[model samples]
Target: MNSNTFSTLNRDLLLNQLEEETFDILVIGGGITGSGIALDAITRGLKVALVERYDFASGTSSRSGKLIHGGLKYLQNFDIPVVKETGRERDIVYKNARHLVYPIKMNFPIIKKESYNLVTLKAGLTLYDRLAGVKKEERHTIYGKKNTLENEPLFNSKLVQGSGVYVEYRTDDSRLTMEVAKTAAEKGATILNYAEMTDFLKDANNQVKGIVVKDHIDNKTITIRAKHIVNAAGPWVDKVREKDRPVTGKYMVLAKGIHIVFDYHSLPVNSSIYFQHKGRMIAVIPVGNRTYVGSTESLYTENMDNIMVNKSEVEYLLGCLHDMFPTLNLNIHDVISSWAGIRPLIGEDGKSPSELSRHDEIFESDTGLITIAGGKLTGYRKMAERILQYIEKKEKKAITPSKTDHIKLSGAQFNSAEDITSLTTLLHGRYIELNLAEEEIYQYVLRYGSNTEKLLQTISEYNAKDLNLEERNILAELAYTIDNEMVASLSDFYDRRTSYLLFDLDKVKRSLEIITSEMSTILRWDNKKREEENRAMQYLIKRTLSFKD
Candidate 1:
C-alpha cells in the first residue's frame, strides 16, 4: 500500500494505462458502485482500469442524502429481504469504514392520529431493529410524546400528537465515495477521475473488448483495451449504453431526489425525522452543525451533468419540511445549499418513477458488456459483490470470493478510536508547532486520516508565504491536493476537498485570489486560465450555494 501506487488522474497516465497495457476489466464510471467493482476485481488479481467523464462522485453519488442504512421506506413495499440484506450490509459498511459512517437514532413522528397508529409504527420499528440484527446496545426504542420531547425538544412539539420508534445511521456520502476510490487505488486498481469512455472497440467477431476515451482536461482521445467492460455510469447509464451495439438491455429508470441544507438551528432536532410528505416519505437527517432536509422524488428529464435545481423542486422539499415541522420557520430563502441526484432505478411499467424499485439489475448486453443499474449508496458493497459474482461465473476464473466485507477501507484501518484521536492530537501538535490554530486541523484530519502526516512533513519546509490561503485554509492542504490528490481544478478544492461553497458561499468570492495563486503555482495555470477557473467556480457557487441576501 505504498502511496506511490496512487498517482494524479492526469492525461499522461490515463493514456498510458489505456494504450500501453491490456486490462482484464475496465469499469466505465467512477462513482461508488463502479469504484466498488474496480476494488473487487483488482483484489481478485484481475487487471482493472476505471474512467470517469467528470470528477469521481460528481453525480448521484455525491448528491445522495448521505445515509448508510437499510431503506426503512422499502418496508412499506413489503420488501423484507431488501431491508434485511441492507441492514447486514450497513453493519459491514459501518465496520469497514468506521471513520466515516456512524450510528444515529431517528424518530418517526406519527402526526395523523388514525393514518399510522402507534401499533403499526411500533411494529415497523421492531421489524427494523430485527432486520438490523438487534444488537443489545443498539436495539430500537420507543418514547411517549413527553419522552420524545425530552430527548429532542426542538421537534415541532405542538403538532406531535405521538411519535413512533427510532433506528438508523447517517454518513457523509461524498467522503465515503472518495474513500472507496482511494481504497481501490491502494489495492492495485487503475482509477482516472477526469477520463471518460466515449465508445467501445470490438473485434471482428463483435465481442466488446475495450474503449475509446477522452481526457476532458486535455481534450485528447485514446483507446483502451480490456477483456471485460462494466457500465456503472449511474444516471448516465442510459447515455453510455447507447454506444453498445443494438443496446442489449434497458439501462435506467431515472428518478430525481433533491436535498436542501438549512442552517442547523432553524430546524434543529436531535434525532433525524421521517414522516409522510404528499404520500411519500422524506427524511430530515441531522448531521454535525447542519440538517439535511431532502429528497423530493420526481421524474427527471435532462442530461444529468447539466441538471440544476428548478424553483419547484426546492419549493416541494421546503413545503414538505414545513408541513412536518410547522414551528421551524423555513422557506426556499432559508436554503443554505441545495443539490439534486438521479437514482438509477430499475424500469417498471404501470408505476410512477418514485414507485420504481430501488433494487439493482445486472444485464449482459448482447455484445457482452455488463451494465449494473438501479440500487442506492447504502447497498453499494452488495452491488459490487453481485457484479463480481457475475464476472466470476462468466469468465470461469477461480478468483477469491469478494473479501471487501473483511477488508477495512483506508480511513478505517485505525486499530481503535484511540488511534484516530491520537492522530487528531498529532495533527493539532503539528498545526500548533507550525503556528496554526486548532480549528484549522479539522480539515486535515477529514481529508487525510493518518495520511496528513505526509502533508505536515511537506509543509514544514515551506515559509509563511507558501502556507497561507485567501480563506485561510492551510496551504499544506492545497499543496497536498497538488502533490498527492489529483486536484487539477479549483472545483476540486471548493466542492470536494472542503464544502466551502456549500457552507460559506459569500466567503468563496473573497477567497478566490489566494486559492488561484496557489493552484496556479501547482497546476501551472496562466493568468487567463486561473481567472477562468475562478469564474467557473463562482458560477457553480451562485448556482448551488445558498446565500444570505
Candidate 2:
C-alpha cells in the first residue's frame, strides 16, 4: 500500500477531488473526533471528506492528558453514564489500535483522612470495573500502604493509608489520530490538512450546502460541496457554530488544562500515580524516558488562539506533584517541556470549572448545521457512532452500522495483545541484521508497529554509512514522515510527528541543521524559506517550553 497516496504530494489532488466530488459527509476538524467520524462514515459506505486548518491532531487532540481513561473521577461525581460508555470504549480503542493504546496501571494513593476511605474506594472501584466491563481477573486491587510504598517509594508514604490499583489506557494522542486518518484514507476518504473553511456555502434556503475553504500552503481557495457538514472542531466548535448562526441557550465553556514534563530520573516512578490536589485528581505518568505530570483545570477565557501555560498553571501542577510525592523537590527550572489544552466542556453556570461535564452533545441548527462538542478522548469512537446515528436520522438514509470495533488501525496487524508483543520481539531481532542499535530498533518497532519493516527498508536503501546510528535513525524517520504523514514544517515533524521536542529538547537543537538541510532537499525549499522554517520552529519550541525571556 503506497502510503504516499496520503502524502503532501497528493495535497493538490485531494483539493481537486473535494471540488469535483460531492461527499455524503464533510467533516471540519482533523483531530481525533473528526478522524473517528470520517472513518466511521466512510466505512459505512458514505463518501467522506475531512479538512483541517492545521496539521492533524495539532489542537486539543495532541495536547491531551494522553490517557484513554475510563473516567474514574466521573464515578466520584456519581456520573455513571460517561464512566460506562468511556470505560467500555477503552477496550474497543485498544483492541483496534493495540500499538497506539495499551493498558496502564494507575495507583491511586489513599491519603490520611481523605474523602475516599477504603470502603468508599473499594465500592467505587468495583462499580467502575463493572461499568467498564473489566473481567474478574482484571478487577481493581486494593493494596496496603506498606506494599504501595515498597513498590513505588517516590510517594509520600507517611500520609498514605492504602492504594487502589485500576487500569487506564496510555496513548500517543497525535499518533492515534494520525493512524485513524490514514485508515480513513485507505478506505477512500479525502483528508486534507492546512485547509481552513472560510465560510458556509448555503443554498437558496440559507441552509449549509458546502464550505469555501482555503489551503494555507498553496494560498488557493476551493469550494467543497457536500450533502452534509459536521463541526467537530474540538475547542473551536463554538466559533464554527457562530459562522452559521448565533449561539443561544446552551453554549461552551473552555477549561484550560496544563501539564509539565520532567525527566524520568528526576521524578522516577514505576506505575502511573493518581493523587488529589486541592480536592481535584491529577495524574503523573511515565512516557518512555520522561515523566509528565498534569492537568490543572481552570476556566479559560483569555485567548483560545494561543493557550500557553502560564507561570501560575505551571506552579499549580508542580504543587500537585510535590503534594503527592513530597520527596521529589522539583522546581520550575526542572520542567523540560509543557503544554496547555482547552477542554470544550458543556458549561453549567452553577458548576465550577472542574465540575463541568465531558459528555458529548450535538446541536442541529435550523439551517441544518450539526456541531459535536463536549466529548473526551477515550469516548471518540462511541461519540462518532452517536453522531452517525444522528446523521442517519437527519439524512433519512439506511447507513451501515459501525465496523470500527473490529477494524484494526493502520500499522496495527496483530490479532491480540500477545501477538503485538510477539511481533515486536521478532522485528527487534530481525532489524539487528540491518545494523541498527537494539534500543533504536525497539523504539522503531514500538512506534511504527508492523510498519517497522518498511522503515528498515528505507534505512537500508539510504546511503548513510558515514553518519552515526542516531543520525541515520532520525533521517529514516524524517523521510517516512515527509513521504507518508504529510509533514509540512519542521515544527510539525518534531512536535506532532516525532515528539522529540517534548521529551528531548537538546536533541531537537542538535538535529536542527541536518533536518532543515534534508527537508530543504526533499521539499525543494530555497535558503530563505529554510531559514524561515527554522525560525518558526525555534519560536514554537521556545514558546511552548517558555525557554525565552
Candidate 3:
C-alpha cells in the first residue's frame, strides 16, 4: 500500500485536509461518475475533493450487469455516436484495468420470422462492428445452428435460426470504481466515503461556494470549501439537485433492474448469453463456480435507495430463463442471492421504462450547480472528462488534457494482456507456501492484479501467525483493502470489495468472525461498534435474500 493511501484509518486526517483546503473542484458523489470526474480533475492539475454518503459504488455502480459494452439496443436504435464512443472507451478501460475489465464472448441467438432473422442479425452485427471500429480478429462470428447448439446447449433451439458470437467486456463494477477512486486519491484528490453531504453552502449571490457534510465515522460536522461543485450522485441526483434549488427542466426517471444468482450445480452457462425473451434483453453470465442471470427492467418511483429484488421479479426472471432454457426450470429457491438497482434514466413523456434512453446529461443550474445524471458503466471516463471540460471553460482555467485514457489504475501492474497469465504463473510458484489453491490464487490475481504480490509479501513477513488459508486470505485482503482501497465497513469488503456476499456467501460466513475482529482492531472499534458492524452485515445479507416488486 502507498504511504498516503486513503482508508478508514486516515478518516480524521483526510477530513482535516478537506476542511483546511478550499479545492478547485468538490464532487458530491463517490460512485463511478464522481470518482471518474475526480480522477480526471486531479490528473489535469485541479485540486479535487470527493464525498460519498456511503461507500464508493455502494449505489447504482455496484449493482450493474457488470458489462463494459455499449448496449446492443442502442445500436439497434442507430445510436452510432454513442456506440462508437463507448466501443473506443471500453478499450481504454481494459488497458487501464485489465484485471477488472476484460474480454468475454457473448451469444446472441437469431430467431426465424421473428424480430431478428439470420439476415438481419448478420447485418446488424456487421454495422455494430463497424460502428465500434472493432479489430477484424475480434469482430463478430456468425454461427450455424449446429455450431450454436454445440456452443450453448442451455438455450432453447426451437426457433433458433443461428447465433452471432461477438466480443464483450466483463468487469467487476465496484472494484473498477474503487480503483478509479484510489487513482484519484493518488493524484492528490481528497476522497472520502461514508461522508454525507447534508446541505449546500451558497455565497452572497446565491451561487454555490461549498458544502456542509456529516462524517459518519466520527459523527462530526465538517465544512468543505470549493470553487466548483458537481452532483454526480447516481440515484439521488434529483434529490441532490433539489437541495441546490427546485429541480426544473430535464428531470430524472428511474427504473429498477434486478438480477438473480444460481450455483453451477443448479444451472450452468458455458459463456455469456444476451437472450431476448418477450422483448427484454437478459444477460446470463457464468463466473467460475456460479452462474448469474438478469435483469428485469420495470418503472420504479418509490424505494429509491434500498432497492431490492421482489418475489415477482424473481419469478419473472425464472420464467424468462424457462423461455430460453426450458429444461432448467429454475425457481426462487434456486436463487442464492438477488440484487436490484434503480437506473436514473433521463425521462421522456409517455416513454416506458425500456424505451427510455441511457444517454447521460449535464444540467448546470442557474446558481452554478452542475448535475450529471444517466450514464452506463462503460462511459464513465468520458463523462468525467466532459465534466472537467465544462469546468475548464466556465472557470476559464488553463486545464491540461486528460491522461486517464492510458493511465493504469492503482493495482494494474502489467503493460499488456499476455502479461497477466505470466504474472499468475510466477505468483503461483512464488506464494506456494501460503497453501491457497491455484484457482484461488488466480482469483486473487484477477482481483488485485499486481497488488496480490504486495499482499503476499506482507503476509510472508508475519511470524508465528495462526491462521488457515481462508482466514489468512481474508486477513490479507482486509489489510490491503483498508490500507489501499478506502474500505469503510465490513459490508464494503464483503459485498462490494470481493463480491463474496453475493457469489461466494459461504466464504463470507466462514470469515465473518475473523473479519470483524480484524476490522475492530484496524478501525479501533469498541464492543458496541463491533456488534453494530456485525448487525449491519447481517442486515445487508438479509437484503440480498429477497426481491422487491
Candidate 4:
C-alpha cells in the first residue's frame, strides 16, 4: 500500500487507528515541540501517535519572530547555558535543513547615544561565538559604519554609529514545524491534524494509559492507547493537561506577539535588522519580496485560540517602525497583512513578558502523563530529547541517544548557497514535475522542499487543464494534498498547506473555486459535501481575515 494511503488523517482513519493498536507514546499537540517529540520517539523505534486539535502550527510555533538564533539579548542577564544550548541546537537544525534555514547576517543598528555600546556589544558577540562552538562558518564579524551603509543603504545615515556582529540563523517556523511532523510520519509515526485530545485514559492504578480524542472534522470521539502520553500543546498545554490532571501547577502565562508585514520597498534593508523599540527587541526580517516587522510582548487575557491583533498592537508596531527606520515611507496603508499568536511563556513574576525564561520543564502528573512546557522554537529538538530521556528513565527503557542532531527533515535538499533559481526556471521545473505552472513553484518549494517530488508524483496523473488553477496554486497540488498530506478540508490547504489566507486573503479567495473543484473530485464529495467544505473554509477565512478588513 502507498504510504500516503496508510497515513490518511481523515476522521474515520484516525478513529480506526486509535482503536486498532496500542502505541508506545501518544503525543498531544502538533506544534514544533510536539512534532519533535513524535519524531524522537519514532526514530528510537517506539510506536507513536501524534495529534493536533487545529491545523498544524496554528499556535505560538508558527507565529514566532522566525529566528533560530542564540538569544543575543539574553546574554545581558548572564544566561550562558541557554545561549550555549540554543547555539548547538541552532547549528544542528541549520545543518539538517540547509535548504530551508539560512545563515542570515543580522544587522544590529547601533544608534549613536545608547542601546548597545560598541565595546560592550563586541564582547557579547565574541562570547556568543564561543558558545556557538568552534564552527568556522559561524564566527562573529563586526562591520564599521562605512561598510554598514554601503551594504544597507536604507538606514538613516545620520543616526547610524555602526552595526553589531552577525551570528545567527533564520527560518520559517511554520514550515519547520510541519517538516518535522512529516519526517516523523516517514519514520513510522501516526500523525493527525484536526484531532483534539479532550481527555486522558487512566488504567486501574490511575496511571495514564491512553488518551481520549475527538475529531474536529467529523465531530467523532475516539480513544488512543499509549504507554506514555506527552502534552506538548504549545499555548494549549495547560488546557490539555487540565483534562488529565487537576491543573495543579502554574505552567504558562500567555504572551501575545503581533507581526506586521509590508512591501519589500517599504523598508528596503539588505540584511535582517535587530533593533530596540521601546526597550523591546524586534526583528525586521526580509523574506522573499516582503519584509516582516514586528513582535510586541504583552500579557494576553484572551484564550489562546481567540488571540488577535488589537489596535494598540498595530499602533505599537507602527511606532517602532517610525523609530527604527525613520527615513522609510510607511503607515497602516503600507501594511499588507498582520497576524498574532500567544506564546506559552513559563509563568513567573518578572519585570515584563520578555524577561521570562525560555527554558523548558517537564511535569509528571499523578497519572503517568508527562507534560513539557516553557521552551523556545530554537530549542525544540533539545527539549524533545530532554522529555524523551525523562520518559525513558521512568519507563526504564534503554533507548539510543537522540539522533535528531544529524537527521534531515523532509523537503530540505539544498547542498550549496548558490543553488537558488529564478522564478521562470523554478516554475518551468515545477510545471514538469507537479503539473503546475511556473508561478505556483514558489508555493511548492516553500511548503514541500525536496518532498515536492512526492507531491509531483501524486499529481502526475493530472493534465495541464486539471492542474492549472488561478495561477497561484495548481489543482494537482490540491489533489496531492488530499491524497498524500492528510489535508481533510479546504481550511487545511489554505491555513496550513500554503498559508495563502494569512499572507494574501484576496488571492486565496480568488483561487478557492478551482481548489474546491479539484479537491471535491478527489474526495468524492457530492454537491452537499462540496458546499459544506466551502462553507467551513469560508467561515474560517472570515474569522481570521475579518479583523484586518
- Report the number of the highest-TM-score candidate: 3
> What value does the lDDT take at residue 415 in candidate 2?
69
Q: What is the alpha-carbon lDDT of model 1 when measured against the actual structure?
A: 0.75
* lDDT measured at residue 535 in model 4 versus the true structure, 0 to 100: 91
The count of backbone overlaps in candidate 1 is 0
* lDDT by residue for model 3 (52-93), tens: 999999989999998998446677778888888988888889
Off by over 4 Å in 2: 1-3, 348-356, 398-400, 547-549
Clashing pairs in 4: 208-368, 411-450, 427-438
List all candidate RMSDs to the true structure.
2.9, 2.2, 2.0, 3.3
**In order, how many clashes per candidate?**
0, 0, 4, 3
Q: Write the per-residue lDDT of candidate 4 for residues 506-542, one digit (tens) a residue.
A: 8778788888887777666789889998998787766
lDDT on C-alpha atoms for all candidate structures: 0.75, 0.85, 0.85, 0.76
Top candidate when judged by lDDT against the true structure: 3
**What's the TM-score of each model vs. the native?**
0.92, 0.95, 0.96, 0.90
- Tell me the tens digit of each residue's lDDT in model 2 across 1-549: 243647876777788898999999999999999999999988998999999999999999999999998878888778888788878888888888888787888999888867787888999999999987986766899988789888788888778888899888898899899889989998999999999998999999999989999998788999998888999999898888888888875578888888889999888899899887658878899988899998888888978877788898888778877877788898998898988888788865566656666678888888888889988888888879888999998768675567898988888887676776677677667766667656676676567777777888778766446777668778778888877888888977898888888778888989888989989998888888898999988887797678312
Across 1-549, the per-residue lDDT of candidate 1 in tens digits comes to 124545452447546766789899899998888988888887878898888888878888878877886667777877888888888888888778766776777787766543465677788878877876756777767667788777766666766656765557776677677778878877878778788888889999888998999887777888888888999998788788888855533547678887788778777777788777557778888766777777787777777776677777777777777766677768877778777778877765555655665678888877888899888898888788889888888979664568888888876766555667777777787567566555455545655666767777766656445335433344556666655666678887677656666665666677677778878886677788888998888778777853223
How far is 242's C-alpha from truth in model 3 (Å)?
Answer: 2.0
RMSD in angstroms between candidate 3 and the native structure over all alpha carbons: 2.0
> Over the full model, what C-alpha lDDT does candidate 3 score relative to the true structure?
0.85
RMSD after Cα superposition, model 2: 2.2
